[model samples]
Target: MSTATLNVRTGPGLSYPVLTQVHRNQTFSIVESKKDWYRISTDKGEGWVADWLVTRESTGSLNETGQQGTVSTNGLRLRKGPGTSEPVVTILNKGDIVSISETSGSWLSVQSGNAGGWVHKDYIDLGAHSSASASPSKNKEAKQGVITAGTLNVRKSPSLNSPVAGAVHRGNPVSITGSVTGWYEIQFGKSKAWISDNYVELSSTPVEVPATSSEFTGKITVNSLNVRSEPSLNGNIAGKVSKGEKYPILSERNNWFEIKLKSGKSGWIAGWFVQKTVAGEQKKSTSSTQPAGEKVTILHNGTNIRSSADVQSNVVKRADSGETFSVTGKQGNWYEIKLKDGSTAYVAGWIVSIRTGSGSESSPSRNTSGGIRNKVITIDPGHGGRDSGTIGTRGTLEKLLTMKTAQLLADKLKSAGAEVIITRKNDEYVSLPSRVSLSHYYDSDAFISIHFDSIYDSSVAGHTTYYYRNYQKDLAYDVHESLADRLPSRDRGVRTGDYHVIRENKQAAILLELGFLSNPAEEANVTSHHYQDLAATAIYHGLNDYFSN
Candidate 1:
């Protein structure tokens, strides 16, 4: 479709109610069209926007206008213009939602759902139109079968020792037919397979235990850690839970434990570094009862295998074998697997596959959630403690200032029910690596570094959002525009920076200099409580703009 710019209109050269403003590089959806006007629906709501004001940079939403309601995810954009040459946007949050209208080559007509604006898809998911559905729903039919015992091989192929495919959880099911030595033949529906007889517990009738609740399954950080009761260090140890272990989460009480393991084993696991996995995430295979020998191939590169999924401190290796590994456990594709060396590894979802497996591992790529999409954001407060970033004229330490701003942003995000992470809570020097590490470590949706601007040239004034990556440009633009509109400072405009913090960072990364500290007037205004809150509000809205679109 041909791209257009949307102007929220009141009269010629005038606009009111504003409903919401779509800034440069933000995206939106075109629900309908009329002469010189486009009826647009954003994360905000549906409204009539001027076609002149709407630019090709504006993106549409996931809900396509066509029937069958094909969802479009590739609409998020980081843009210079509606054109590809525009310096790419960067630092896109993981779950930033966009409204896609049409596309050409690499350019996508888009807008942020929350903060309305036009942006290009240079650095975002440029969803291509498809006539077919993405995939069938996983819950359509829950197949029932018997469990085959032993070290069941869920191979990509129906073979044995075929690179030792994944194992079946202790009580899952399978359709047993015959046996080959210690291995038993099973029917995995369209395919038949063999699995070891050591690990499974077989039952004919489908035992109707209370269906697994859609509950949080908290994590265990250590490669092999034990679950225990009571908060005290000397509490009673319940059982050992492995890394990436999804312990059925009970409720949390202070620093203590509360969990439910397999087979109704309920107790507490320590609350440090362990977080419950979100529900609907622990989706069991259709053949949960069948220990089929299914296999998977590495779909992306740099898939990390760890001693455990707990900490990155123990990375075993970057994967090889484009190896067909079995899926022992899957919680959002951060699968738990027994490595070729009998170790464990955490493979990101995008890097591997269970069917038609053929792909390379070790390449840098990002994974998007299949459904129930939510935004993932990482907020970094620049400098802290002794490393008081740039000092302001009024003696306000940049670190202190940004920390307060960061806190405001964090609170706003949390209140909105979004997962928010602040790099530092106290005064302490945080290495740049650590900052980037935190974002990459979590496979964050987006990485935003908060800071105030300073320069030897005191005349360099106003606020500017710096982005090194193309995908982050719209984010910078939306945020910077929000700040300019909310605060009294002149818009320094979003610009490109080669700052190490933005450059080296892998995820969508942006650095904001919230007005120049060297300018007494701007500095004075920024230091005010109102301005601080204003900045926070702007950032929040900018984020909303990016994700809501």
Candidate 2:
């Protein structure tokens, strides 16, 4: 038989029914042949398939078709009809060969002897000598756009401030057009976004709002709140304000404020620290007042801690002589002490006798700062919950892999004398921005994100590291170099990336693509425990280098 390649045709026109996709190979049985059509016997029943898609044998047994090997991998669901949203009839498992009865718009109408429905040809491999090549058609390049606001962010996804892919300063234009969830879609303007929808914006030409200096009215809430020159905590403190005083909000910077106090002292306060009143004055919330609890006088000069635990780890700050506090509860040798400034601290139980009500039940040490241990190192295993990051071959989920590697890395870091803090301990998804926010919440010394890589071409494979901006390049290099040396796979070489989570982070950050999951060999290696340990070790060493330097 002169073997020929099969052409999975979609109707007469390629427009309405697009050639959805092609399988590597599949089988077929021809019952009747026409000029350009063949009525084939499928498991479902009789159906007409395009004759152009079949190659025949010289013996003429199946001059246009051949039977492919049968084995069960996944079941195929029967569709009500052809097209994208067709309803499923039922799922068919392997070992069952259905007859191909007809073809229309990329769908092959089939029958399993008695049962029948249409199946998208691409999903099932039909054994036929096909001359066609399986490759992705070139997609039109999407144009990027500019950031029209004072500052606009490119995210890991289309949502607000998703882990920042990169940032566009005021007036800088970007090439963005695609959109998802009310946000413009951008993939780092190229393949760099390996993750889709990594950049977003409202529209290409956003309505410009003039940057006019505006004043807001509100009351000061804290007794002695430090007013800063900028919104960030690191911003210079312009002055201090007394509680219950009124101020005019001069301008806004995210959650920070530019304000003028009633006493004519001008400065900025964290927006979260004050609430705007109806009269335009800012009012302090309950931040300045202490929570309800029985006051206590320490008997042994109570030492203030972060939680009600005496473990060397429990102490974040120490209470000095004459420090008064309200005893909220108690646990082994520790009391939950509330400071006069409304902040809660844990005090040593041996130094303070409960002067009032008993303390609350002692919770797990891990529940609150791990019950005062040594030092806590926060670890983020990146990507969870609805985000299906760069999918790899054979269904290796990045989220699962990252979590596993993170856990391993945490253990290694802990063994080296540091308490580990894991932002997420499960498979639940978390946004990139949230991951960064959580890192700040824990004040982690370093943050690492683990992930796998996927490429359109299966041949491209290796590992790489990414860092946002210049400050984190050293961290990226350390992790990348360590991974290259420790991992058992091929190194793609460490390169700089504008990943949002790493770039926007104020703390040291590094993201590692351990290996390309799309690459069969690399994918298998990444799934192995041995490789995971190597990855963990590399990351640990990288952190050590970063901190040591």
Candidate 3:
């Protein structure tokens, strides 16, 4: 079932031609699958569909498919979905023959006699046969490319070494999926071939606007927000604005807001610091967009409103002694404030006297400051919806913890002027491939996957950062150092691992194992609010250093 209106392509990857269109709630039986796409028996006939747009369910045991596999493990359980947490539909024994349908990371959708579900690919032996299925729907936006070569061979896959099935001449038109680096899809039957676009003329021309999108109006949440020329941190600074200012959201790409600037220009702002007001409900909304909580009092006239939780951050404006501002959020020893012009700035916690709604006054001691500005960062909160992730000794759920961490990290990053994109905003299962695809689509400056680790041994506890490619090791080391410093757990250091999210990602990616949920004492400490804030602050500083260096 498609969760939203979806596109059915001729082959697995985005480079393929669109066969037809399907709307939400439209059901299609699985004919076969390759990679992250499924060959579904739709009403229009069998076409490839990206698995991310549809929800999977066990529809009884399926028949044989193109690719076949043998169960390697004895008594391997077949769950309804890819993850281990998904309910088991049935079980299989060693050497049991199963038809491989689709794949989601390390898991494969398979079928056998009276049994249909997902099993770990590690427990399945799929021979040397190359499954002719490949999916590319994660990059659903429209694109077109013109062939440059007078004669070019279209290979069966993205690789140049793959066998050529056909050819296309100059002046032939092709749909660009941007799924592969050098290849443009001009798909054929079972042997879907791709053409090289090394010198081809390409343009990003969107064919359709997703039906699920709605009108949005955004109110500035930060003190002074940086508007970028493009929907990324790398985009040149086009303009600036202050808090409380409202603008019609011209467009939204990923989590960046494209708004009409005051100078009769258009620019994109990080959506993290913008209060979204959907069309219609704008009038009944509250005036405050910041999370209303503690209020701070200025002791001396000419006090400064620094841009971030740092003393060195440029003074945006001056404040008179005894002036008060709501403490929207706290970062170590800094109090985040929204100025009259709607500029967000940080006042040192040690200097300002804090007053909460309950009338209690206090001063903070801890001071923290490193912030990375003008960078596009993607935060992936691992596991969601049906995937609960690792369950800790104290019943600490890794999914919820990662979400909390990602939120705090995003807030701090936004305050520091970086555009932040989150893979999962709520409790929803996002496939591993989709997460990496988003990073690629956004051309993110950095990608961080947040997760809490676990093991059978309850006594071991620590925070470890994992990287795949050598290019990402520096990021892992930088982030892990800060996490190990701020977190109240052991320092496991940085190491290379084969995690799918980081391994498959083309961008600078790293995965953080913030702490061990298997350890009882560590779980209690890691679940605390203070620890999470410190962790976020530390990571923020780490990125600051990484980008600066």
Best by lDDT: 3
Report how far off residue 302 is in candidate 1 (Å).
Answer: 40
Q: Kindly give the number of clashing pairs for every candidate.
A: 97, 66, 10
- What's the true lDDT of residue 446 in model 3? 92
Best by TM-score: 3
Candidate 2 wrong stretches, greater than 4 Å? 1-376
Candidate 3 per-residue C-alpha lDDT over 188-227 given as tens digits, one digit per residue, 9 for 90 to 100? 3222346654434443332211122335557786789999
- Candidate 1 Cα misplacement greater than 4 A, ranges: 1-374
Off by over 4 Å in 3: 1-331, 335-371
lDDT of 2 by residue, 1-549 (tens): 112433333343222243333332445565554434555554445555454344433333212222222223455666767765875544455544554545666766654422356676776566541222221112333554433233344444432212334344332334443532224444342323211221222232322222223433455656678888677767797788777676666666655667876667677886544644223111211111222455544432234456434232455666554455766543322456667677776664423333333444332222322222244466777677787677776688888888888987775454344667787889897777888897788777767777888886554567888877677778788768767765546788767777887877887777778888776545766787656765776676666656555
Task: Give the Cα-based TM-score of candidate 3 against the true structure.
Answer: 0.38
Better of 2 and 3 by lDDT: 3
TM-score of each: 0.33, 0.34, 0.38
Q: Tell me the lDDT of model 3 at 393.
A: 70
Question: Between which residue pairs do clashes occur in model 3?
Answer: 12-134, 12-135, 12-136, 223-343, 223-344, 224-343, 224-344, 243-342, 300-321, 301-321
Model 1 earns a TM-score of 0.33
Estimate, for each residue in 1-549, the C-alpha lDDT of model 1 and write its tens digit. 212334454332223456555555565666666544677676767766655444534323332221111223333335535554554332134444444545555445443321222353444443442223321111122233333222234542222312222234333455565543224555432344445433333343553222356434565656766666665445688777787766666676654457777868776665654643333223444344223554556543444565543222377776653576765653321456656766556655434555422433232111222210245678888899779989875677888888878887775454344567778888888898888888888877677888888776553567888998898887778777767766556787888999877899888779988878865445766776546666776787677666655
